[model samples]
Target: MQAVNGRILIVDDDPIQRRLLEEAVKKFGYRSKSATNGAEAVRIMTGPEAGEIDLIILDMVMPELDGLGVLERLRSDKIPTPVIVQTAHGGIDTVVSVMNAGAQDFVVKPVAPERLNVSIRNLLKTSALEDEITRIRKHASGTLTFADIITRSSAMERVLDLGKRAASSNIPILIEGESGVGKEMIASAIQGSSDRRNKPLVTVNCGAIPDSLVESILFGHEKGAFTGAVDKHVGKFQEAHGGTLFLDEVGELPQDVQVKLLRALQEGEIDPIGARRPVKVDFRLISATNRRLIDQVKDGAFREDLYYRLNVFPIWIPPLRDRIEDIPALTRHFIARFAAEAGKPQVAGITPDALDLLQQYRWPGNIRQLENAVFRAVVLCDGVQLTAHDFPQVTSAMDYPAPSGVPSNSAPIATPAPHHAPAPHTPGTQISEPIQAEQPQSGFEHQAPFGFMRNLDHDGHVRKLADVEEEMIRAAITHYSGRMTEVAKRLGIGRSTLYRKLKEYGLDDNGKDAAA
Candidate 1:
């Protein structure tokens, strides 16, 4: 990879020291800019040229405004550019003050080129990571007010209305919905419209991470905190120190991680894994889950206090089936979007019958699934408008049976390592090897041995614990709104175990009877 280039701004009242530092910075292949005093540095930073300067070297005793003053201004203005303080005072108090003032790094007076260079390189690396995250989140780009949502249904309008009111408050927000129901979209809209719109809105996907990495990912860790922990990582909370931290799939958080997260939320502080002290953070919290956390709390899988804390401003987004009135408007918006993305701007709209078919159907995957269908149609279409033929699956979807726990708007399905594939069956084919055809065989030739707890009926005949355990597992699943991750967690079993039980019990995620 090519070396990361950066622009350095030198701020010192003394032209002699400033010129020396500028030349030293240039010698290291970094472009340099100069500021006569701290005041000038603040102006340039808060002005048009702010984005150009990656690192600032500010002298503490500048005539007009000192180092601390400039740092304070930067902090107040929320400028994330890294600053290195140059102070004659090498006292510990001065160093602490600089850090407290939000300066990223500092060096003692008569700055050594080597020491300054090292600090700059480290800060720039961390800064680059943060910048990339910020670019992806796009604090301002993905932001939405209620206006951006295309909904005609009053039910959805109420959700957007409450979201609008919630945007003005700093209270914790809990969004509940089925998967692909636009929970993150609502959370981002709230963050962007809130008072801290200019600050970062960091998102954490709780279920996406491995259990072992949960604590480190959410609370961060110091360098050498654990094996393979090479550098200090500021967690999601710190990343959105003044804005918002949206924890998606929060119910999937492990017991240990939930404990630490509870403490952080309650105390407004976090103890990084290897840090000497706890770091204080002040940010709004937004959590989303398709599962009912209240049920998980009852099952002892989730903390009661954390649930209460997050549910302060509860907003439930109704599923697509419940608010089908919004389908047409949503379809228009998505077609326009996917068409432009696919470089087919001339695509006018969907056919009237096609729109009717979409409205008539119950979208199990919600808005996310709808978007995928539209995008796929736009990419494959050869006409100016999409027809029912464009979405052949939609016509057949009514009769299609969905698999357990997999959303219609699901991400790419993970193909597990196959133990075996089913044998091909031809019409009128008969197996004569095993002639007892009345008893059916399982699809898999090799079934993993499942231990069962035996029980006796009132008649005293022995029976497997299958009936009792199946009821409990099925009830837990229904109560938790069919979130298998939370179900497995509450049932004190691994996810693979839960899958086995679900299949063994003939249960699906329909929130009703058995799959058969």
Candidate 2:
């Protein structure tokens, strides 16, 4: 059964341990698979089941391959699959090595089912949040006509519908979304399709302009307007007379500049610097902001009246994740466009499997990011179509799992693995299907998916996770009213482990009572 939470890949040469792990993971609602050894795990992870495998459990010591060896290989290839290394007795040093090599977590020999499951749940939760945040944070770019907006998603079609309607009038249009959902593209489309199409379409990035020059840039300046006034100049508003002026990132405009902008919009004119009289200007306003100006107005950063003026027609562009239905068409369009530009006759299109991964992958960068990724892949294309391996940035970014329980502000400690052979990619595999335990690759053959993390501090000191772990345990105990079970649940640890940690950290209230 496919897991509603996610899938797990268990790697151990020992059949008993593998079976035990499989049952434990399944008991926790995760679908799982087993690899006889580390080699098989690498193949499955880098091959067709690449996208499907969410987490991996590997034995530290195996026949031909070991857990540390596998971790090294993965780091070299930059695969971000969260790994839990289960080690044998007296393997603290090796476990430390595993942690330094970028393993998300490690389990000592005689693994308790609850402890292992707790780690898995935390990693999955963290990974999901990271993907969601990244998808919403990164921005998108470029300009094109409405006809160039290729999308099959109904959500996006509605965006287009509203944009086209707003374009017909001179009312200010506010296009919004998380960065990179193509706000600028919609702005361009509106400008292109609007009645002002024949007029010059001028654009300005409000956030990029220096605060001191914002007013002068928006409204023309005369000679001797200021110390740096070399010659009289027409600002964006005056230059775009009878045309459309697109102000991107308009939320960044300073309050002073906003007031001037309001006057320009309301009176249909501007006061040029050093001018004896106000200058009459006629330009259609098309402003765009990624942030909610409503919130800005509430916070007093934006003027309410000005916001209402600019928000006559508001169009929200959903992030790429919301309209993933457009991935295939967008992919095809990108492949063809980039290929022809590069004069690569070999580039035909994307494979069904590759397209699946693309769609499955969260697009933090949106269409602009997709365009860049496809262009890069096309340049690296050895086959007739773009393959998964060609888009390492996408795959690596997608597969990087965020381990839960990490503080929101804490950076994950990642260490670069020493030189190790990379994991070999398998052919003829699909991510959604069960991974067959295939023959192990001869040796470590490929680099980590992302280059392994570097030794962060001088002397490449390993972070003492024990200190952080103890602090967290104490914090949990204080916050949870000394309820061991609740603390364990919150921290993604088994009750026994929580008790052990409490005793180890001298925070065990029960143990204190017993001593008394």
Candidate 3:
């Protein structure tokens, strides 16, 4: 079952019943409070403690004002909270009446904790879905254009085109690429291009939010819902009403959260913290990740249901290495941009050799690294053009050959050049030789073969063999286009073993070939 965020408010005229419900919420790892009547509940809901509540358990029959009456007040006042009605009266008419009155779901007086939990989960799921629908509607009518992105690659251009089409439709979109490949930018572009441009584009970094706050962040809470909640704070779902909600690093969302998120997509409403009702929202969901989500589902880190919901339309951004041809255009674009920004008209362009060096190197960090490199070069350039000497040699280290006369037994061996033997001279001939010294390897030695791995050794300990093995495995997978079976065979391991290794390395094989 799905896990709901833990801020619940229990309202019952009977003290015993309210206490029982409160205890149940606590037993299930939720934080909750109790109210003797609907008036008290609403007062607490709108008070200083408003931001901590996620759901409300309201008793239908009570003194002073009935549950339906309270729900009407909430709706009329525009209070966005999910309310579940509880009544000793267990008739279809009663359930239907309360439901039509804006209650998300209704439960009998002798409700089981499991049943209550299930209803709450379903309500929260529906709340999220409604929010997504609202966001989509708002974005579809908005202004999303390609001019917002900073890139010259045709790959990016295609992405923008796809984004425009996807934004216009209600279909869910899955954006896949390496980290720092601008997946979020694509999502933003889609939002901008859609009808909901006037509405807020809420962003939820699935990887950044702690597991505990995932529910409250998505569905919002009522006032006094928790210990620290000073006031009501709308969640991303509510905040994105009639707009777009982008879930970045979606693969990192916890398993339980995935289930609820899936339900929200299936439904179209969300149960807010301490809310006695589920609010309907209209929003679009645009999700992005560097991970292969299908693999995560297979490995049980992500839900299969959620995967299907998000995979309706997929857009994969090619890495810089795959689109090396775009490097020159990108370099010139960035040079002009940085030069103008830095007020450096004298530094007009990059030397051909410098451009060649950049084109030859493999960019593991993708476009982000390339942009940084250009920015660094622009800042350091002293003349009208940036030459190979001005540009850092470390940029080309991955493709450089090793120096001659180095021992083969060196801890790390570099590639050797072929077919360049010098002619032998007679002894004491005193022949003058054209001297060509081997380029120094010190600068290159410390540079990681790919990207960020180089900086990990600042404390001066060699990376463990396991780390090396994992890097090689990842490199092999990338080299083979995420073909796991091919990688397994190359590594001389079984497919199962390879899968286990991938889990161990936190790698997923959904986008690329998992079966070779």
lDDT of 3 by residue, 144-243 (tens): 4554454445555666667777878777777776676777767877777767666677888988999889988988889988878789979898888888
TM-score of 2: 0.52
Supply the global lDDT for candidate 1: 0.71
lDDT of 1 by residue, 392-471 (tens): 77876644443355333222221221233234222122111111223222111121111112233323344346666775
The candidate, 1 or 2, that scores higher on lDDT is: 1
Displacement of residue 369 (Cα, Å) in model 1 is 0.5
Candidate 1 ranges beyond 4 A from true positions: 1-142, 399-516
Model 3 residue 277 distance off true place after TM-score fit, in angstroms: 1.5
Cα lDDT listed for each candidate: 0.71, 0.68, 0.67
Ranking by lDDT: 1, 2, 3
Residue 37 error, candidate 3, Å: 84
For model 2, residues 1-516, the per-residue Cα lDDT tens digits are: 121345689999988887888888766655688899889988998886766677888788887778888888898998887888888754667767889988888888797887886677566544544443342232122223564566667677677777777777787776766567777667777777776665677889998999998988989799998998989989999888988888998999999888989999999889999999998998888888766564466468888778877866666566676577777656765665666678885675565556767777666567888889989999999976678888998676556332233221121233332233223323211001111123111111221111122221223344367755655565555444455677689999899887777677675443232233
Per-candidate TM equals 0.53, 0.52, 0.51
Decide which is better by TM-score, 1 or 3.
Answer: 1
